[model samples]
Target: MPRWFYQLASPRWSYEIMGKLLPWFAIVTAALLVSGIVWALAFAPSDYQQGNSFRIIYIHVPSAILAQSCYMLMAIAGAIGLIWKMKVADMVAKSSAPIGATMALLALVTGAIWGKPTWGSWWVWDARLTSMLILLFLYLGVIALNSAIESEATAAQATAVLALVGLVNIPIIKYSVEWWNTLHQPATFTLTERPAMPAEMWVPLLVMVIGFYCFFAVSLMLRTRNEILHRERRARWVRELIEKQ
Candidate 1:
């Protein structure tokens, strides 16, 4: 195993690393989110087609992107826990559930809001929409399963299996617009294609996307740190740290 892997396996080291990283992620999330919102809403030019209503893209796109990314991260964490039996990985998998769920919900609501003006309907059983809903349910199911199991290790194991199974839905969600005759538009940004809009518009969107990721990291670390403390409360290092407080 790599030196870094050993370092990560140490709960004390993981806790200390997160403690150092949390503030940086928090600061970047706040700065980028605030600047991205202001620039996207006020300064960025509106779509020639949708006009002011298209402003919702600033929020909808980033959240939608983050929703999928969060699930991917959560599942990866679960896989790490399952394979290596790493306690920190389990904590990460558990911590990420609520954040992923919230991102999915925000994506759904914002998509609905954006839809009302563009698609002439607030809700639709379109492929992308339905698949995103499924993603939310998957996150919820993981949380529920974790809560239902009494043994922490057993709960983590079960949640890990569920998360791994749910990975199939992710690809479906990604390609739904292309694979199905959906009302939702195709991706505006792709690795193989240039952006649909000019730099003025897409730049802030890029910032927003990066900010959302930073925000996710901040939230995951906060929750994972709490989980570590809770699980390790009886340990000498943790107890000593608590006594110092």
Candidate 2:
């Protein structure tokens, strides 16, 4: 391979490496989520207005963050596969769709729950919320197309195209609330601006965000490893791997 990372284009190499790394990711993901959830649910202070209902932020915020991030991750990996014909990249893109969809669903559901208390409604057709809904549909479309196609290469190509096209929605999703006046509040967290909440509140949100990222990594690694094994099953290395198992 010309580059260190490109060598992992090989499905066999990807599988072995993923197998080795999965346990560590799983452990760390579990630890972070457990600690974060406990701290968020029990120790975090209630909002002055939203009351205990605001505690849903732990799940809602993390899932919302992961939902967007995973889609970008899939789109990037899809781009790599499209440009380089890398089987591992395609596998990563394929494996990431369902996970991303799950996170999106969680975000919507948790958002609705949090919304019911704050907004007096379970659903709203606001800009940010609508764009997030589209994101979920895009994830589902990718997964469905991947499953429907008979040929792996064709499936990858088709899904990659969809991912690339769907990327247009990412910016829209991000800026929807800004572009339109909506019930959804402006971002609570921002890179340049100081957070609106006290450190005690936002700190737990940050922790949950990090923990959710670890959980996503753990989930993606497991799914990617499974995909690699399936795609490489006919290879000599994979045969040897199965024999060892």
Candidate 3:
């Protein structure tokens, strides 16, 4: 709404502001992650049902949430680039692919780790697991497409189309537990109902989720800034900005 806020929509200004903000976000993320890990691993009481295995939920859930969110955010960026011819938006979408893919990989691996003793299997074809695997494929597809193409613009366009098409999977992943019988448990954290875990258990999970989001934000900004510089290397404004820094 404000003039200054709108100015941030500009890639040059966004990079500058985000560069200044990155250290603070990094610090906060480190603090939150450390506190959350300590609280979840030690201070929080073990689950009566899963014992120490439930502690894996903190990392798994948060990474899964971030993985999904980052995909959606990247899709939105792709849409903006395609619709408005925004170079910055395309750059952002490009930069976000690896990070989103990493989060998805973490979510899947952590989920598998939590599943082994509880489910008696390392993998499952259940709805949630199946949908998540598809999500990972989508991330890989986007990243691979980005790298395979020669021209950045053409790559961005291809990835944007792929991301837009992949958007259909997001809802499927979110609602898979509700829609079908699955080995995977339903949402542990829900906005509308009381949490399934006790305060001690869920609180650390909430902290970890917040920390994951902050870390994602910081990563996106840093990656996008690098992209902005790489693309804008010939711009006088970029040269001036670099000189000032």
Candidate 4:
């Protein structure tokens, strides 16, 4: 085991590190979110076709991207716990569930809103949309399974298995539009290729995407910190910190 791995295994150390890091994520989240919203919603040019309705992409695309990424994080955390029996990893997996679920819900709602004008329907069982809906259900299922189990260790174990099983859906969600005759358009952004849109449209979107990631980082840290405190409530260091607070 490397030194960093051991450092991560220590709950007290991880908690303290997160405490130091939270403020920085919070600051960046606020700055990026504010700038992204203003730039995308207020200043950016309206779409040549959809007009103001297209601005919803700023919210929808970022939410959709974050929704997928959050699930991956939860699954990875769960895997770490299962492999190493790390209590901190279990707590992280548990803390991540609600956040991921919320992001999924946001994605679905914003996608529906974006659909009304462009696709002419508020909701559709299109491939990409359907897969994304399934992703949301998977998130909810993980949350429900965790809540249903009584023992902490048992719950974490169960959640880890379920998260791993649901890993199949991520790819399906990513490729659905491409593989099927879906009403939803294909991805507007990609890493390997340049964006199809002009900078005016994509630049703000890029900012929003990064801002959403920062926001997710902030939420994950806060929730994981709370989970750490609760799980370690009886530890001497935790008690000392609580008393200091």
Candidate 5:
């Protein structure tokens, strides 16, 4: 392994690095979110059909995307912990669950709000909607399982297995719109093709997506730092850190 990869296993190193990076991520998140919200709500052209109601996409789309991305990160972090016995990875996986759950909830609530305007109903059994709901439940399950176990290592192992098993749901969520005749629309952005929407609208959406990612990074780092300190409270470095503070 590279020196940097080995360094990542060190809780103190991970915590220090996160502390250093947090400010930058926070700054970027604030800038992009503010700019994106302003550009999206004030400047972007309204959809011909949905009109002003379409502006909600700025929030809905990014939250939905972030929820999925957070799940992936959680699962991957869990895998690393399982494979390498890395405490830092376990902390990251543990920290990710609540944040991911919040993002999923935000996505679902926003989706319902957006759906009410577009589909004329606040709730639907549509494939995409149902799958997204499942995703949220999966996050909650991980969180519940983590808290249920008394041993920290045991809890990490249990949640890691659950997260890995839940990976199957991610693909289902991604393809639900295409595989079924669902009321939900397809993705707004894809790497292979230009967005159907004009530049003026998509630009802000892009900014919002990037901003959401930065926000997630900031949240994860903060949470992970806390986890590290708690888990390593007995360590000399943690004691030193506390004494210095």
Candidate 6:
């Protein structure tokens, strides 16, 4: 393993690195979200079809994207913890659940809001939507499993296995629109293809997506730092750091 990878396993080192990175992530998140929202709501042209209702995409799309990304990170982190016995990786996986759940919920709610106008109904059993709902449930399940287990290590392992099992849902969610007849529209952005929307609209959406990732980083770091301190309370470095503060 690389030196930095080994260093990351140290709770104190992880905590310190997060502390240094937090402020920067926080600043970028704030700036991007604010600018993106303003540009999206105030400046972007209304959709010819949906009019103002399209503005909700600024939130819904980003939240939905972040929710999926968070799950992948959580699952990968859990796998690392399971394979290497890295406490920091476990902390990251644990910290990720609530944030991912919240984002998924936000996506669902905003999707509903976006749906009412676009689909004539606030809710639908569209494949993409249903799979996204299942993703949210998966996050909740991980959280419940983690809380139910009394032993930290046992809890981490249990949740890791569950997360790994749940990984199957992600691709289903991503490809659902294309795989089935669904009310939900195709993805606005894809790596290999240009967005169908005009530059003015997609640019702000891109900014929001980047901002959402930054916000997730800030949230995860804050939660993981807290988990590190709590899990390492008995360590000499943790105790000394606490004393210094």
Candidate number with greatest lDDT? 6
Clashes of 5: 0
Instruction: For each candidate in the order shown, give its overall lDDT on alpha carbons.
Output: 0.93, 0.89, 0.91, 0.90, 0.94, 0.96
The sequence of per-residue lDDT tens digits that candidate 5 reaches over residues 1-245 is: 89988899999889998999999899999999999999998899899999999999999999999999999999999999999999999999999999999999999999999999899999989988898899999999999999999999999999999999999999998999999999999999988999999999999999999999999999999999999989999999999888998
The collision pairs in model 6 are: none
Q: State the weakest 10-residue window (summed lDDT) of model 5.
A: 126-135
User: Candidate 4 — which residues are off by over 4 angstroms?
Assistant: none
How close is every model to the real structure, measured as TM-score?
0.98, 0.97, 0.95, 0.98, 0.99, 0.99
Stretches of model 1 off by over 4 angstroms after superposition? none
Residue 149 in model 6: lDDT: 91
**lDDT, candidate 1, 131-189, per-residue tens:** 99999999999999999999999999999999999999999999998898999998878
- Cα lDDT of model 6 by residue, 1-245, tens digit: 89999898989999999999999999999999999999999999999999999999999999999999999999999999999999999999999999999999999999999999899999989999999999999999999999999999999999999999999999999999989999899999988998999999999999999999999999999999999989888999988987998
Model 2 worst lDDT run, 10 consecutive residues = 1-10
Per-residue accuracy of model 2 over 1-245 as CA lDDT, tens digit each: 46758877877777777778888878888888888888888888989988899888889888988999999999999999999999999999999999999999999999999889789999999898999999999999999999899999999999999999999998887888889899988877988999999888888898889889988888898888888878877888878878988
Q: Write candidate 4's Cα lDDT for 1-245 as tens digits.
A: 88888788899999989989989989999999999999998899998889999998999899899989988988999999999999998988888888888888898998888898898899988988888888889888998998899999999999999999999999999998888898988899899999988999999999999999999888988888898988899999999998997
Off by over 4 Å in 6: none
Per-residue lDDT of 187 in model 6: 97
Error at 183, model 2, angstroms? 0.5
lDDT of 2: 0.89
RMSD of 1: 0.9
Ranking by lDDT: 6, 5, 1, 3, 4, 2
